[model samples]
Target chain A: MTNPIVLDVNNLAVSFQTFEGDVKAVRGVSFQLKKGETLAIVGESGSGKSVSTKAINRLLPVKNTLIESGEILFEGKDLLQLSEKDMQKVRGNDIAMIFQDPMTSLNPTMKVGKQIAEPLIAHIGLSKEKAKARAIELMDLVGIRNPNEAYKRYPHQFSGGMRQRVMIAIALACEPKILIADEPTTALDVTIQAQILDLMNKLKKELDTSIIFITHDLGVVAQMADRVAVMYAGQIVEVGTADEIFYNPMHPYTWGLLASMPTLEVGKKQLYTIPGSPPNLLHPVKGDAFAPRNDYALGIDFVEEPDLFQVTETHYAKTWLLHPDAPSVIPPEEVRRRKEKYQTVRMGKACGERIGGGAIGSGG
Target chain B: MKKYIAKRLLTAIPVLLMISIAAFIMINLAPGDPTNLYVMPDATPEQMEATRRALGLDQSYPVQYMRWLTRALRGDLGISYSTRYPVLPILVSRIGPTVALMGTTLLVSYIIAIPLGIISARKQGTWVDTLLTGGAFIGVSIPNFFLGLGLIYIFAVQLKWFPTGGMLELGGNASILSVLHHLVLPVAVLSTFYIANMTRYVRSTMIDVYGENYIRTATAKGLTKQVILTRHGIRNALIPIITIIGTDLPRLVGGAIVTEQIFQWPGLGRLTILAINQREYPMLMAITLLSAVVVLLVNLLVDMMYAVVDPRIKYD
Candidate 1:
């Protein structure tokens, strides 16, 4: 059974009023985060994945950013409509966020324990001593050796991976219902990235907190995400279960993304890259924002913006290719090979009867 | 930390010695003899030589420096040619008034500028920011002498609200009130520049600090705007601002020459100008040495403060 929805963002549009003009950063994005599941929003730089998640907690800068339209429904409240005073109570208590670039994401002047204790003191109204105790506990929970000693240390004293763990500790301090991690491991080493992802998975299971993981790395998505939302040019182009997005992605952009993944197959002449850059958001997008870059763009994609068409009960793709009247096109070879490899692995596992039935069922 | 301090202090010895040598040489090289004002113009060359000898100016450069350094080491800064008094005692006496003036100026400037700067950074492109920025620019651009004269004219001369200048009102009792009344115009002039400078520095530094990822993290933690600005923003911004303030410490004794001149306030700046005009070698050298020591010590203090303010900084 599906977990209950913890966060429902509907038609969220955000724009930044810059000197040139309004740059539409996030254009009509919608997604639901279920309890205890990690929902990864994957995209290239400036694709609005970070912006959308930042908007969830109303953390966007007040001076220039304008939420054009949206309703961030959390619990029974529309967070967008809540006053900043009320929103403060919701933030770090009901919802918390961890940012990328652990090197700069923590206060250099503050002790790590105090940074972690800040939310607890501010939200839970814990006494300083109690908060310190809890903060030490959290430091330990995040796998920091000698939590008591680490607490008194500053961010600079910690390594990049350790700093990120401190960041995660700070985010998890209040036992928040929703944790929005914006590329939490992008700035870390690859091996450390895996460890952080594993820690997050472990924490997610232990804490039962819903996570909105924003990242550009698909490998990270495969590691931690229960579901994935593929963003492109300020819009969610496709969203589905991890299995569907990897094995049976329908959107051309998704196909391009899957094709771009480097493989170990011998004599694969060159890696496939999606041709052209994302559309600039300065001027209004006339039709499909991705039409210029999309090799599989139909004639109608040039004149009309395609709606998110349903593929399966749990899958949806915003592309004209998903329409019934549209011409059928085959996915790239790499994507098909990936799906076949997964099926073979599944069959092998099934025949061995070593893995659980539930694990096999969940793979679909 | 103690070792670091000791090392810094040790390094300061050569630095102070070099400063003393430079000051001694520069003063001797300057036009006019210290004996010029004492001796008659038509006095014989032998008489002039006698006056120079008595004042210890006839000695060779190295010999004179050695004599001065030895005497200074014994707390004897020599007698001032102009005052006929010991240079160290005069400098010590002047320190009180100058410190009072500069200390008040620093306190008043930081107290006013810090809050305004924080407000300016927080309110950034708004009209409030524009007004404060414009005011700071005016404060920075205007000459302190002119500002001093303007205040003297309006408050002291026209309104007759305060004394025109001096550490205490002429013929008045040396009460704190009288001293404060005399302090108004000079302090106003001196603090204007500091307030303007510090406000701009604090504003720019804080604006940059606000952009730091930790600031975003603090905001994300749901701290109030005030808490974030004070705790995160100011705490981080303080690193550079402290450097600015620490560097300004030398100015306390080195004094605001123009401001002191305009106000006629009894401070080291006034003493310095007087010494330069009359070629009071001993007084000038002492002031120069004091200033160098202040600068070196302040540098050490600021470096040490960095360790206190930012745990990331290690003395080692």
Candidate 2:
């Protein structure tokens, strides 16, 4: 039997108060995160993926950010209804967040071990001695060498990869059930990014923690996610298992994302880019947000937003092409060939064959 | 760090020497002579010339500077024209009262302004913030001398709650209560600018620190608003403030001069004014050089503080 859902976000809508008007940053976004699952929320900047995740933790600025409508249900309790005092108990203890930019994420004035030990002492009421031991243990667990010596060192003393590892150790200190990483490796170099991602995946498996990974990088999403949710403007346009989203993506926006990613297989000099910018959320578009930028946009796509159309039990896409009366459309040829390549790689992995890292690099 | 401090102190030697020369030249070049303050108007020209020659003021600027520099290097700052006591001894005796008064003022200003600034930043845009910010503007705008007179009028004149001025009563011994009694007005006057400046600084720096990513991380770690503030907010905001306070130490000497004059406080500032007015060349030179040395030492101390507050800053 499939693992039960651990978090259910229903019809979430969020807006930010601005001088111009209220910007509808996240509108009618809904998703489920299963226990021990890695769900990657992929989108370009300002797509509201990060906003939606922050809304779950109520981390948005109290002054201008408003949740117009939403219910973030975690373990049968509506987190939105909980008081900030109660939310404090849930945060770091039940759900911890790893932010982008590790350089700025760790306190410059504080020692790294004390930073990691902070949550432990706060949530578990651990004694200072115990917390220190636990902090050192966490540092070791996150792959930092010589935990005893490094514990007293400040963030600036460590390399980028080591600093990110420190961030992960801090997040995992209280042993939360859910980990939310918001583009955790986007600021690191390519090699460091791979190492960080690998470390996170290993930790996730060992801890059995449900992770909601937010990133704009398809390469990261391809390597780290069990399920993928493609966000456009302020809405989720497509969500399915990683294989289904990679092999049989139905939404035109998802097709664009897949096409735009630079892959080794695509030897052509010209790289594909999405034609136009995301819709301005201040005016609140009447139809689908991606319609203006979509080349395969149908007549009705300009006038109305489509509901999620389920192709399989787990795969759902919101697109006009999924309508019964709409003409059939196909993804670009590049997507089709890449999908075939991923399939072969997957089959080889399933057969326990070491096909090497070249296939995985091309898949990205 | 020690090497950096050594280098700083080494550079200060030339700066102090130049200040001593400038102080000597400016006083000598000015229309006043030290003999005028001491010699009687009815004294004969022979007596005036004898006094000038004895004091070595009749010498050229270079010869006077060399004599003063030699005496200073030997720790003998010559006799004060007004007091007829050794300038070094007089300055040494005055240091205690000035340090105590200014030290208390700075301590009180920091104690009050830090919390007020933090509250202003945390409650930014609220009435509390508005009120505190308004107070800071007024504090910064008001002249210290005017503020000193106003405070004396209210507390000393109207309330009769404290002594009017000076370090202690004329005949009273150095008791804590009497010192505190005298301290109230001068400290209040001296600290007004520091409080205003420090509060505004703390508010601005705290606001900037509140937006930092580490603050968010601290919040996400389930830290209460208070913990997040003390652990992350204040520590980061304190860096720039260290620079402010560190640099402000040298400025305190200038402030003390004005404050000391108004209160009749027996401190270096009052002595400085007395020396300038009386044209006590040796005393004035000593005070100027002493101030320059203090400025260099305090700045070096501040740089060291920067390294302490932020481990990322390495002097090496």
Candidate 3:
């Protein structure tokens, strides 16, 4: 049986009003999260992945942001319709967001322990003594050893990995149903990144909390997401299970993003590349924003924006090539080979689970 | 670091020596000698010469400069002309009022500016921020004397709350309350510009610091706004404020001059002016040197405060 939806974002479009012009940031984006699933939104900078998530919490400056039409339903309430004060209450209570730079997300002057207890006091109405004990427990839960001492320390005293762990602790302090982690590990080194990801995976399992992971790293999405949404030029172009996005992406932009991934091949040192830069949002496009750079674009593809067309039972792609009457094509064989590797990871995760209830499922 | 201090001290000595020489010349260059101002016009030239000789004004410029410099090196700043008493005693008697006024102004300005600046910066681009910016504009545009007179009109004349001038009621003696009452107009006059300047500095510093990565993290981590303001923004903002306070030492002293005159507070500024008007070279020189030295000492203090405020900064 499917878990109930915890958060639903429908047809959300965000625009920035500036002296230069209106910069259309996020457009017609929609997605949902099951009660405890990790839904990864992958896209490059300026793709509105960050903006899309910030809108849910009302974190952006109201003067510049115009959320033209959207319904951000979280546990049945329209988050977008709430006042900032009301939203701030909801934030860190029911829906918490962890930013990219872990160090930047935590206040420098406050003790780590106190910062963790803030949301609990504000939202949970916990007393100081009880909250302090719980804060230390959280610090220990997030893999921080010597939790009692760690709580007394400031943000500066913690390492990057430790700081991110602190951020995770604070995010979980209120036990929010949804945790929006925006590139939580992008600022960390590879080894620390792995640790943070592992910690997050463990926490999600333990807490049974859903997470909306915003990142441009396809590799991270492959490893973390149960479902994936590939955003480009402020639109959700193609979205599906990790297998479909990696093995059988229907849009040219997704193909480019996959092709652009740095392979681990030794010494051959070939650099994969996308042909052109992202389309400028200042004066975006009348038709397909990606058409100008897409090599296989046809006459119709250049003039009309493709509606979201069904590709599979759980897959959708917003590209003209996905149209029923259009000519069909497949990704390169190498891309297919990468999909086989991804399938193996899923298989590995499933087999590991056979050992016991404690085993991780096919989420790797 | 020692080399830097040595260089500053070395550069300072020549500037001070030149000032001493200039003071000596201006004091002697008057058409009628200072002694003549004291003696009757019918007195013999011999009597005037005796007076000049007794006061050591009959000596050559080099001899006079040497005498004063030697005496200054020995910790004596010569006698006052108007009072016929030692300049140090006169300065000591009057230093209380000027210092009190300046000290009060400095305290008030900081107390006012810090919160105002933080508030202004926090709501930048909003009406509150615009209002503060506009207020600072008025503060910067107004002359200190005008503001002083304006305060005099409102508090002294119209409301009759504070005295318009003087350090105290004439026979009130130097009690703390009387001193403060007398200090009102002068300190406010001196601090108006300082508070305005400090607010602008504080606002800009806070704005920059508010955007710091750590502040964002702190807010996200759920610290209270007050905690973030004091611990995150205020501590960092104070570094620049300390530096500005250090550099503005001269202005802080110069500002007291006009206020002193207006209030008849009988401070160093008053002493300097009286010496200048009466051709008292020694007293003028002592007051100028004393102001410079106070400023120099404040620079040392500021360097120390920098380290206190920011651990990253160290003065070797």
Q: For candidate 2, lDDT tens digit of each residue in B1-316?
A: 6788788888888888777777776777788767887788899999999999988878887887898788789989899878788898888888888888888889999999999999999999899999999999999999988988888889989998877787878787788988887898898887888899999999999999999999989888888887999889989998999988987787555448878888989988898888888988788887887788888888888888889888999897
lDDT of 3 by residue, A23-76 (tens): 999888999888989999988889899899888877776667899888999878
Which portions of model 2 show Cα errors greater than 4 Å? Answer: A338-364, B1-4, B28-31, B40-50, B251-255
- In model 1, the runs with Cα more than 4 Å from the true position are A266-268, A339-364
The residue pairs that clash in candidate 2, if any, are: none
| B135: Cα error in model 1, Å | 0.5
Estimate the TM-score for candidate 2.
0.94
Q: Which is better, 1 or 2, measured by TM-score?
A: 1
lDDT of 3 by residue, B1-316 (tens): 5665676677777877776677667666755567867778898989989888988989888898899999999989998866789888887777776667777888899899888888999899999999998898788778877788888899999999998888767786878888788787788787778888888998999988887766665455444577668777787677777888887665555446666776677677776677777877788778777777677667766776776666555456
Native contacts kept, each candidate: 0.83, 0.71, 0.26
Give the candidate order by descending DockQ: 1, 2, 3
DockQ of each: 0.82, 0.71, 0.33
Listed for every candidate in order, the interface RMSD values in angstroms are 0.8, 0.7, 3.3
Quote the lDDT for B25 in model 2. 69
Tens-digit per-residue lDDT, B85-106, candidate 1: 8888899988888999999999
Lowest lDDT 10-residue stretch of candidate 2 chain B: B247-256
